[model samples]
Target: MASPQPVDIPSSILIIGSGVFGLATVYSLCKNPLFKDTRITLVDRQPFPTPDGSSIDSSRIVRADYASPPYARLATLAQTHWRTTFAPSYYHETGLCITASGPEQKYVPSSLANVQALGTDRVEVLTSSDDIRRICGLEGGAPGSGNTGYVNWSSGWADAEGSMRWLRGEVEKLKRVEFVTATVSQLLIDHTTQTVSGARIKNNSSTSTTTLTADLTILAAGAWTPSLLDLRGIATATGQVLVYLPISATEQTALQSHPTLLNLSTGLFMIPPSNRLLKVARHGHGYTNPTTIPHPESPSGDAITVSLPYTHIDNPSQSVPLEGQRSTRTFLEQIHPSLATRPFAKSRICWYTDTRSGDFLISYHPQYKGLFVATGGAGHAFKFLPVIGDSIVECVLGRTPEDFKGKWEWPAERVPEESWEGDGSRGGPVGMVLSEEIAKTTSKL
Candidate 1:
């Protein structure tokens, strides 16, 4: 399908999904005097700041350590805004300590240099095992064990749920944007015009379906983007496990000063304790819900709450899978043995819409005019929050920056099979493809 030609700035915009990207788009558009009259309606399957949305997580990393220059620049911009405007509660500049073993450490020097190149003095190199221990409070630091990486004071983590809620509150205050609690069933398309007119949404409360009309529509549905737009090849939903350990008072005090630690070799990233809870997550090859079933325990008898549609199981009870729990325990045992045996405070399977390239997909649909996609985070778009919406605005106005022009466009095909194989954070091997019955019967693995 040929890419649809651009049209004039839209006066009526319908945005599906109110996660970071959707809220950011609303903020960006509403702030512009030129779009002061634009009517923006944002809809989500759940309520504002949906708990299951990838953007609505416990915490997200805020850093300027990307090996890619454009991303590095974007992170630097977002980091600055986060520190200045979002400092008090939402953003925490606890610092980030990233370690990679030999050979894989190629990105380490460049990552440090990238941050420094941003004209900041926040980067600190840890030269020895003791430096790692004293600076980050992680154990067993040897050459390449984590002692070799640097710590950047400017980089840290943000309270993701808080940040999204804050943004949603601000967006709600805007007169131009209306937040609707609804699920988008399908895109409203004008075949003759070859344009997406709007969307068909089901009100969560009223249970009534309404076709919302708009001059343009933006799909910022996060991990559910592929399911909404059939973007299987270009993007796929993958789930990552997050396990939280409730730390003791003493352990919490000792960890209060520790920075977020990321191990390149193991793809494990650990965030410092916040409210006595510490989070540890793996970066590669997360799971996904390709199929779904109704939850037997759902208050709404027919509510489908499973993460994947491919799964036949309709169980609603939530817990970390055995695999995830094992990984979390093993990593903690290696680095912080004291916290290894602590009971899990909570666990969740966070989903990410990963693209072949770790770059986000923000573009116009090739077959549908007026449909703009602002998804494919590849699990790392949160740090770019401050600037992402502006970029989307630019895309709508045909002013996408040269740096992002090709990088965020849809790939010609699903990433080549070999390339899709886990390459660090880009994600790992494809997960099991279960049958319908298997999906229904399968419990926590």
Candidate 2:
């Protein structure tokens, strides 16, 4: 079968999920004169700021720090918006210290080389644990957590919720979009034509469903995208762990200006504190929650299993597994020994729409017409919140940036999950089953 060409813009576009990608695209479309006559509609399960959405976090690292040149360059471009008018108050130039102590240490230097090549003089190479301690402000000196690392003053972190709220407000100010708050049950596919018209959505849990048809449909649902498709090895959802602890005013002041510390070897990272809350999290391959459900496009209503996101929205009381909690605690003890004994205030499972190679799965569905996919964040799309929409719009017009043409394009075929080699940035545990690990829970908080 011949591939579908993004030759012309659709008269109406239906976007599911109002997260970063959705809002960004809305903003870009409103600004672009080419889409002045286009009717744009956005539908999501929740209102503007999704509670369990990955983009609705307190803080997200904004850095041109990646092992891949394409992403590194793209991130550098996005940072320009971050430093300027794109919610400038929410972005902090606290810097980032990326370290490693295990075989995954290779990612540290490789990322360093890319960023340094970008011609930023703010790069400082850390050859010892003491070097990390000095720059990252780890008074306890974490010799065990990370041995070698580098600090990039050009890097920083952002208040994710604030930024998203700001972006949503900006998009609404244009008044060019119709935002509908509804839960999309399935894509409205015309099987005979092999075209995805739009989506069948309902309010919360109402049995009655309504269809919103359009000339084009873009699925930017983030981690929940796999649950709407038969993405096995192509793209899957993984749940990452996050543990937050309260800090005193003085403690917050001391750690507020410190650079974010990340250990590539273990995937443990600590971003600077905000609102007197300190967060310890991991960026590694997260736990997979395999679920069997009727395939969205199955005419016969056959069931298929896929790794889907099970967030607080699904189970409000669900917490991170014991293994994750223990790992995060160990990371905190290594970085800030004083904070290790402090009781954790809260913990949550953050989901990521991860791809096999860690490259974003952004492309028109090869099998379905009028359907474009824009997900597979791989735990990193938050930094590009500013400029990613323009890029996605370009891809929608069949003009993918030269740098991301192959990187963001959909895979020609699906390979077995175990045989996949990620973008070479992930580290720590692999093949963790969420249920098995949750069953081993032995912690109160």
Candidate 3:
């Protein structure tokens, strides 16, 4: 067997967005032996520490307690990459704690079985409520009794900003990579040829606009992805928010020692912070179009006043106040009465780019050739950025990726009929193959 020849691609590639996805993609591309000689330029509206930027938030937890095998495999691969390529101090593997109550709890068993079938050795299904208490210190448990528990040792938290800083540093070290502060205004597509040649970007100050040409362009603008694609007639769903709060000092101590906790009954997860704060947020719900909502130039003030439904509570559709921190505190108090008195240190709003099918819409535009769109992260997509970057790079290079078929397949249905389950297996079949390839390729570095 002969080795695959290195691809001598174009010298320049332009990436729009400086969030985790964009940054990770640029880092991976620069590191790839095939693109070692390629020059990469990343443009974003905000500066490096993008204020209120989705990627550089206070803290983000990483885990592998997915209901599906594909996600589990991706998480396993990403975790290994983060630990090996990035500093160990950047990530904390406290593990993951998942619990289910009432009829909703049935999903847990099937989810566990799926991962086990994939031969993942990181998960352990706890038999008794006592086991949950012993491992996670949470006292609630019952079959259809609003209580059930499971543990995954491969789950934990990572310093999101720290990770980005490390990645950006690496990318900057490459003589071929450059970062620019600007907003991409228009994608220059050759209509007759059906190919994207470059982009015209307006600086944040709006005093000047410049055009940069590239052989390929990638859209990783997070929540803004849909709007950008809209100019090209591609429709995308706006993703919702995940709010986090801090627990009491005592409870915080226990939770810090505890694994990342996900209560299926409430559709909420508690992530321990590396800096001693606790994060709680809801998962799987879609958000209204952010374009309809006001864009807050600043992260402070009235800009944060968007209404959010309390999906984690007993009532799924009930409307309530959008108290990012207060809601988190109240939910924690209900689950573990002990946290009622703890003062909230802070709160944050995170956004996800959703798709109609509840899966990521990472594919090439049917009409716009050479213009790759990576949106619809659906909510749990952050953990898969490393491999997702690999896939995106492959797509831009016009190579058939093992994971592309499954990812680009358009679903007949607009949105998933059922509620989004976090049991992990969302990535289409052939997930293991893609995951293994990513691990093998990335592990070499």
Q: Pick by TM-score: which candidate is best?
A: 2
Q: Best to worst by TM-score, what's the order?
A: 2, 1, 3
Residue-wise lDDT of candidate 2 within 89-126, one digit each (tens)? Answer: 99999999988884446788889999999999999988
Question: Could you tell me which residue pairs clash in candidate 2?
Answer: none
Candidate 2 ranges beyond 4 A from true positions: 1-6, 102-104, 442-445
Write down the lDDT that model 1 would get: 0.73
lDDT of 2: 0.88
Write down the lDDT that model 3 would get: 0.59
Which structure is stronger by TM-score: 1 or 2? 2
How many backbone overlaps does candidate 2 show? 0
Better of 1 and 3 by TM-score: 1
Give the backbone clash total of model 3: 14
* Clash totals for all candidate models: 16, 0, 14
> Candidate 1: where is the Cα deviation over 4 Å?
1-4, 127-130, 139-147, 292-315, 416-418, 421-445
Q: Write the per-residue lDDT of candidate 3 for residues 1-445, one digit (tens) a residue.
A: 1112233476778888887778777877887888877778888878897755667765666766555556666777888876676646778887777767534456567666756676768887776656666777664433211256678776777777777777777777876777888878767767677678778888777678888788767777876664455421123333233544454476566667677766666556667754556555655343442233322222222222222112222233322224333445555665566654565554434455555434565555555655666665656666665566786667555563554455444333333323434233221111122123324545654
Model 3: residues >4 Å from true position, as ranges?
Answer: 1-8, 105-107, 120-122, 127-130, 139-146, 231-252, 290-320, 323-327, 341-343, 399-404, 409-445
